[model samples]
Target: MSNQHRMHGVFAVPTTPYNADGTQNLEQLAAGVEHALDTGIGGILCLGATGEALALSRDERESQVRAVVEAAAGRAPVVVGCMAYAPAEMSELIAEAAALGADAAMITPPFYGGLPPEAAIAALRIVMAASELPVMVYNNPHSTGTDLQPSHLVELLDTGSFWSVKETSGAATRVRELRAALGDEVEVFIGADGIALEGFSQGASGWVAASAWLLPEQCQRLWDLSRDGRWGEAIELWKGLGAALGQIEDNPAFISLIKAALSRRGAEQGPVRPPLPSVDTESVDALLSTIDGIEGRALHV
Candidate 1:
């Protein structure tokens, strides 16, 4: 309800680490979270798309949440992704996150296709009713067929139960439209990395991105530049990193690229889980070269 718990600036979605045996490497995950916090990220989001939330088991999800929360250590909010097709299951996930000391739950509408918008909205309302922590509406129609139109968001967010919305439509204009429609009724965060500058120009309050995890200082610089109204400088900064950001946005190896970049940066995020192969060395090398050209050694080629 209040803006007290709302997150601003960059919230890095750290990738989940795994041991060679495929068990969750929570210690590695916690180390990465601590590193992100040290770079001054506004918050941490566990079990996000970048984190491969759906690939993890329930127990693994709880372990990851606990690791991130402890790693953040109250320096920033820890928002857990609680995505489920059923409202009861979502509520269960939220309860687990709450018990694990998460600050909030980021939820998307049910992923099942052909579900009407009303069903999505109704499902969110039901889950929110049972959630102990505040909820952030994650509208990522690309991954989930259900799209929460601005009208639907107006209805759900107007209830004052939601803390924010992550708009990942990949269209920057949606940020402008949401701002125009909502007018500060709910904080809007840009979930796509490529359009971040455009989203900021259009009044997005923050960013929830994998790039933010891989390149925290640079991403934070972009957020700071935008926040300070230095449009010219922001444009120049974004342009400098366009190549790497483009790879982040459009590559099929979205998660893999982020992980490889993090490992290249010396954070050591291991392989992605099954069904999702790691990006080839050639792709990783090319991305690293592009990243190095940005003039920061924080990301070595």
Candidate 2:
């Protein structure tokens, strides 16, 4: 609302690293956070969609959140994605996030067949009741199947219970709608990486981009360019990084392809969690080619 703690800027939804046996790779995850912090972006979001948050167990998610908070060491705020089916479990994750010294939490409504607005608000309220920490309502209907719409979200903000939101609905028109309806009231963050330019242009404060794992400076450039009325430059950079976003945003499991791309860069954070599967050799090859294309453009520039 009043913008006191709006997560406004290039927030990175970094990938989670697992070992060959699918165990959590804390060391590699720490390294990823360090890279993100050094990227000079605004925040590092561990255990997010890009981090395979859903694929992680509750215990694993807590540990991952703690790992990112520790790695950051206050360089930038750590926003943990606390996702769960039940409200109690969500609250448990929120408490764990606060206990781990997380600066804020990005929470999504529970995904199921489809939830009513009442159920959605109830889930968010459960999360809000559990912690004194700021809570960001993360809406991505594509993932959740149901949502707490702008009207419902605005009402929540009016109560002073919830904090901010990361809007991943992937519609620029909705960005404009939220800003128009609650511009001076709520803290709105753009979530989708592909449509970042459009979202920011419509008045979103920042992005929790998937491409942030490799393209932090590019995201920063886009943010700065948009702020400075440099849409042309921002779009160029966004276009340049399109491949990386495609590998994740359109994929079944976002974390898998992200790690695959990182492997090409020599980070090699191992496989994605079970049910998500590792990226195939062909996908990996194409992703590397795309990265090379981006690098080639940079070189020519």
Candidate 3:
């Protein structure tokens, strides 16, 4: 598929499911892929922040990517997150994803010891040169320590090195700026669920949403309403889902919350791996309450 086609619409970022023993759960991964596709999402982004890519070992990461790709079965495009602190490592991850049939790769700026803008660009150049799959630059300044300024992003885009950018700067204005700067050359996907409406209003190509993992239908409805210029309905839908979205935005244990919510709905989403604790009973109850409020149905909590 063309980059434009793959990059548009609701792209759900699924959490990687792990069994009680911390082993990869391909069954749940497959179910999650099917569930997301059933919601009419345009694409699936595996091993993303929501997926806890950094927490998984290389073998587990590859298994999760392969599972999602296999389960998707071409119903929608799959974009794998290739987040690494070095060019060689990132390139290898991208290669694994490409071999597993992923349509694209999403990369963040090198972390740990932050790369300067020029160095970051150089790293990206190496990864881009190493793979044929389309690339989506992920701008997550909070976690990456290095923010890709608009000018720097434009420079990278000018190299024809990237197909899109997942803007997590939490600034809707940045989306507008990117659109104004690069026009249609680089698609800008909003990475913050809280600012999705604002980003879409500013011409964001789509959303890379964690909330969409469990609430895909609602998320997709909002995306469609906004994309079709039905601002009134879009805003209303967004308001209705705000409580659920806020849980993700406010909670540091959001991945656990997401998996818990899915489990409440009867999916064997499994538990989050250690170093990342599971949500407390109160938090889980609150999340389910929020979901129930938006869904208007008592989930099997």
Query: Could you say which candidate leads in lDDT?
Result: 1
RMSD of each: 2.3, 2.1, 2.8
Ranked by lDDT, the better of candidates 1 and 3 is: 1
Which 10-residue span in candidate 2 carries the lowest summed lDDT?
154-163
Clash number for every model?
Answer: 0, 1, 0
Q: Give the higher-lDDT candidate: 1 or 2.
A: 1
Put down candidate 2 lDDT per residue, 32-73, tens digits, no spaces: 888877868888877774356777777887788888889999
Candidate 1 ranges beyond 4 A from true positions = 296-301
Full-model lDDT, candidate 2: 0.76
| lDDT digits (tens) for residues 1-301 of candidate 1 | 7768757889999898777788888888888888788887899988985458889988888888988999898999999999888889989999999999999999988876546778889888998866788888988887778778788887776455688889988764899888887777578999888889989999999999788777787888889989999999888788766668888777787788888877887777788877776687887888888777786733552
Question: What's the lDDT for residue 240 in model 3?
Answer: 63
Instruction: Find the number of clashing residue pairs for candidate 3.
Output: 0
Candidate 3 whole-model C-alpha lDDT, 0 to 1? 0.82
After best superposition, candidate 1 residue 18: deviation in angstroms? 1.3
Per-residue lDDT tens digits of candidate 3, residues 201-298? 99998899988988999999898988899999887777768778887788888888888878888886787877777787788898788777777732
The Cα local distance difference test for each model comes to 0.83, 0.76, 0.82
Q: Clashes in model 3: which pairs?
A: none
Q: In model 2, where do residues sit more than 4 Å from their true spots?
A: 1-4, 49-51
